[model samples]
Target: MPMAADIFDRARAASRDLEGVTRPAWSSEDQAAADILLGAAQEHGLTTRMDAIGNTYARLAGRDETAPGILSGSHLDSVARGGNFDGLAGAVAAVTALAAIRRAGMVPGCNLTAMGTRCEESVWFGIAYVGARLAVGNMDRAEFDALVRLDSGRSIADHMTDQGLAVDDIWRADGPEIKPANTKAFLELHIEQGPLLMEQDAPLGIATAVRGNLRYGDGVCYGAYQHSAATPRRLRQDTVLAVTELLQRLEALWHEIEDGVDPSAVFTIGKLFTDPANHALTKVPGECHFSLNFGSTEQRSQDRFAAAIAAMTEEIGRRRRVRFVLGDPVGSSPTPLDPGLRAGLLASAQSLAIPATEFATVGHDASIFARAGIPAAVLLVRNDDGSHNPHEKMDLGDFEQGVQVLAATMLDLAAE
Candidate 1:
């Protein structure tokens, strides 16, 4: 293959390295992975550090340490067997973007920090957004204590105790240092996950906006179970049947979430379980809790879409009898971007003769920064898929093009 066509070359080691690192539930190979990357970063002459949650950061300081660094990173941990690129791409791309600039001897107005964030996939527990959430102070003790892991049947605090970290540490976000770090704007470039660019035949599209996301829905009904022959449909208080009906209703609402009303929206039943599930033990009705995500919209469309979802919430409660509950409206955010930063990226892509477009799909680590009132936007790349799958692959040719685009964009952004 032509060398420039091999876009993912900078990421080949880190991307492939994911397969060798086995961080199965509750067992972290993250320390080892973080250590390896930390060393790689230091050797590259980047300053490095770790967070309480183990978010590994590498810094390329500009002339001013006084200036808050421009931040670019992605979460490192993956959902069990998750493909390599979902989070890895952003980290590698950010580092490579800096490296490319270094190769061409570009200087900058402020320092740059490339982070490989952790605990994003809930691998060891249902600790989604562990790195960014803590960084942003969205996570706290009461919240952590209240969380339950469906697979493990234990409180997140129980998981924390088992892992040797104090649950109370989650509240440390209010401290002085935490706020400064959190103050920096963050940018993350991720795989589109949907077939947009590949189908559109474009090199990239600037994220004009990202939809905020949240989840809540639990179903549990315990009556009794009987052999299919013995159980009378009307006479039996079939808990299993109840849950089944709920699922069908929820799914219909979900379809409506995506098509019936909010066709530009997204919803997913990401995790779920029904207890009394052991086939060998007892035939009892099970309890199930599942997560839901409503996402996707352009900047101009987010409010109308959110309003529609809010209306659906009332209907969901009315339809489900099994103590249905929705989470406190969380992860809500408006469109945010560094106008100066974004303008440079957009104009640079056009000047470079690279294909570019402007749009936004859903929220990400970048959104976390935008919410914190920082300038940020996502940059899309080709040759990526199945963000958390083990067999995931990245197209090297597309990766190279991403590098060039990123390199050019950064050079322009840092231009005085």
Candidate 2:
């Protein structure tokens, strides 16, 4: 079996571009990444193929072909300008684990399928878990048609056309579906994305749940535009200040709730912009827009946050003399990871003498599988910086340890 560092190095080499890991779903870079995984799978004597929605799977055949296969791996697509380890690490570990199992000459009782999923980041489109949803036959036609990529303005179907898949074939009821019944279990290894594991001085951690989120993808605050020189400070309805006030109040509210209720609750403003095409330096800004992302593991906490936002919006509108129009929230609810799988993962870590902690994650593909009733586990390797950025750093030593835990867990579960 190859060293875990070598596997990561190979993955980085495959996606080494000017823009950090620029393998958005359905892009040439994404296809190349898939091909790289496929090559690795075939080299290990595993049959490989891609499904309609571009989920690449490599299977090590078992004695009982009729038995549900053990599925392991993660998405290969990355957010634009994202770090190489975000989604690619898990897929590499999956193949590496399978290769190690093969090298041990242990033929499993059921098939071990390594997968590299697509569009899990939702950076290109507004939808998350696209590839996994399609694989599990949970995607709807309307939802697929409505998913428009921000950069290309093309629907997911348009991208599917480019990939040579019929739009109608994205979701299936009969064959080719990868659901809980057909898959015995799912396991993924990912970078911690945050400093939790590193701060705790641990090399690996297991996720307890993935936090649910409320998102205003296109939120805006409106006020009348006026000449900056002519308008008095008190009389002018500045949209920038209007938005800022609400954001400030919201942050305060977040702290209050987090301190008093759930400490894990969090919120963020992802994008803030003012129309530059029509604005001038001399003019008071008329409109301001920003994305709102709030999340927590508890449903009631999210409910409270939404209520706070609504109340704050009304107050901001009345005080600033501006209108607050928030876009509809879109996101999945918090999903609990499988306890059985969690225990197994913990046992593997302990047996290997690796210190591990369990925490709630913001979002991840493993959560989707867990929500769909498939037992799932997420192994987080300690990293120096958060994911989805160019400067993201993950320790190669920590990743190797994570791979060891994953491989041990797979062997334990696959043993007859």
How many residue pairs clash in each candidate at the backbone level? 10, 0
Lowest lDDT block of 10, candidate 1: 1-10
lDDT of 2 by residue, 1-416 (tens): 35446555666676776657777788777777888788877888778988878888988877777887788888888887788888888888888777877888978888888889998987789777788888776777787778888899987788867877666766565844677778888998888888898789999989887889888989989898899999998888899998988899889988987898677788999999899886789889999989889888778888888898899899878888899999788866777788888899999999999999998876778887777778988888888768888778887778778878987887777774
Residue 266, candidate 1: C-alpha displacement in angstroms: 3.0
The number of clashing residue pairs in model 1 is: 10
Best candidate according to TM-score: 2
Clashing pairs in 2: none
* Ten-residue stretch with the least lDDT total in model 2: 1-10
lDDT of 1 by residue, 210-303 (tens): 6655444442444444455565555454444555565565556656556644455555667556553442233434344555555655333345
Maximum-lDDT candidate: 2
Off by over 4 Å in 1: 1-28, 141-184, 213-263, 267-293, 296-340
